[model samples]
Target: MGLITEARTEKLMQNFSAIDFRMSIEDFSVRVLNTLTGVIPEFNKGRVMIKSEDKIYRCAAWKGFSDDIRNFQISEDEDPISADDTPKIYRNIYNIYRKALHGSMEDIMIKSGLPEVKVSVVVGIFFEGKIVGKVFLESAMDIDISKYDLYLLKFVSKVSSLFIGMKFFQERERRYHKDIIMAMVKALEARDTYTVGHSERVALYSVHIAKELGLDIKDVDKIYWGSIVHDIGKLSIPEHILMKPSKLSPVEYELVKNHPVAGEAMIKDFPWLDRIRPIVRNHHERWDGKGYPDGLKGEQIPFEVRIVTIADAFDAMTSDRVYRKSYSLEHALSEIIRLSGKQFDPEIAKVAVDVLNRVFPVIRNS
Candidate 1:
């Protein structure tokens, strides 16, 4: 029994690993149900039903059942009993299982039609310590319940609960991080009202160019973050210089150039921002090493930075600035293309052109 328990635990761990590696929920559910059925052949025709957000129990996966039962749906308040007042085996199992939650000791076999079956189990699924759902299992033949079997059920139940809890917390953490990043971007935008929608436009353009260039998922995520905080350093610059109506003098222009450095410094304490530092610092660097505080040449700047540079420029050219009118989409595209190899990475420039062409039909001039 110890060996059997160990083997089952190992298999369950493997399934959990597959789930943790980002398998689709459907696939994970199927694997879990299969695992459960494999351990107890009497459950060969068992099904796993998930309680959805709408309070509907939907048949997520099953091993065996007629087509009619396989696709069955039940509302939360609806009982599984028949109109004739006869409880089906599944309904009896659910009723008995529900009673277990309250520590009721009424024999399940007394209610179930399968009186010959001697062993029964009720397991709860929990997410964050709250019982969200349950699983029911019964023996097909007379059999004495063993300690090992009970332990196995407990282990499987605990695993399911932990997975659900982890997933819940993971989603919450993702939303929290997203909110923080958005709030930071908003704060930056609020400080410089002239560029209200700048980060969003840059993010959109960066993603488009990333897709056109066939960038990997990691690279795309990096570009997205970079575009959002490209001008974050402007938070450190004086409002008068940032919102100046006329062209910047040499001194003021130099102060503006230092923004990238300032932005980098602002986020340096965050380890996650390390991936985006290059994009923030080098978005203004010219392809020929003619732009910015650090004149990084072609192929010397990070590829992600190069991709964002074109996106940043395209958005800026087509956006209304305090000093000048925005250019038309066609004019912006032409200007970008003309600067390719000199002011922008030629490959990235071409990709940006294709992205703008396909996505924004009306590239309106400001």
Candidate 2:
């Protein structure tokens, strides 16, 4: 009774690879449960429960159950079942109804008007030596699980655990890297009182434009991170020059213009940030070949860098500088539209003006 054939196993693996685990947890949970039910059609009812920080197992996904089941919880200290790295079978689930903690499964099922469960299987989803989730398969009639059924369940559980582990570690690594970058931005901002929030605003505006242009998630993320650290090279400039209350000398202005190349060089050695080097180096490049560094004209500039360039210019216009007051929102948007074909990519500039018009007003009022 090998229920899980080689072809079925391969199909399941292919399905797993197709899922984008970066989706919301609720969506991920439902997909996982549905994928399992699709493979084993006999298990008419099931739920996926995730372990929360409060040590309670809350149902994250469920099918063929009343809405009341959505609120069901299982305490970590309960005697209903033990979750190890294996699936446990129960000949009669009713026997565990009273064994479970009060107000958990018993009360919820009663209120939901669920029928009697004749048999059930509980599979534990484990990660890093702890049970992170539980998968329950139940039936109203006494059903026998073939050896292949158990093997397939185990395979699914292991695959779920692997994805869960990878997602958790990736999020943690992203957070760690973001923290370091923010700290650098803060230090750089502290050196110039007038530009305390320039980098963050530029990043936010760039993301808005990127999304409006319907860029994919990966490019949107690159635009954001690159914008956040776009001015990293300016950290090497003397504080006196950055905070100068008057117009900069030719030499000082030249030093200021080199920040993009300097910033690119500063982060060149970090493999994780390597992809964004062009963005940091070319955000100031012009559309008509009059800009600095490499003077990349037209499409020669990276698309992401062009996006950040518009965002940077818009924010700088709206923020007060050491030598002048900030421009009005109307003036800034008009200026962006005015220079669309000259200083900026005409297409990105058009999209950016629309996005900034809707987004910046709320930000200014807030």
Model 1 scores a TM of: 0.65
Estimate, for each residue in 119-206, the C-alpha lDDT of model 2 and write its tens digit. Answer: 6788888879788888777766677886666777787788778777777788789999999999999999999998888888899899
Q: How many backbone clashes does candidate 1 have?
A: 0
Q: Which stretches of candidate 1 lie over 4 Å from their true place?
A: 1-6, 14-126, 129-157, 361-366
For candidate 1, lDDT tens digit of each residue in 43-116?
Answer: 54444455667876555554444344344555556523221111123333435334433423233323333333
Give me the candidate number with maximum lDDT.
2
Give lDDT: candidate 1, residue 313. 86
The alpha-carbon lDDT assigned to residue 347 of candidate 2 equals 93
Q: Residue 6 in model 2: shift from native, Å?
A: 6.5
Question: What are the lDDT figures for the candidates, one per model?
Answer: 0.69, 0.82
TM-score of each: 0.65, 0.74
Best model number under TM-score: 2
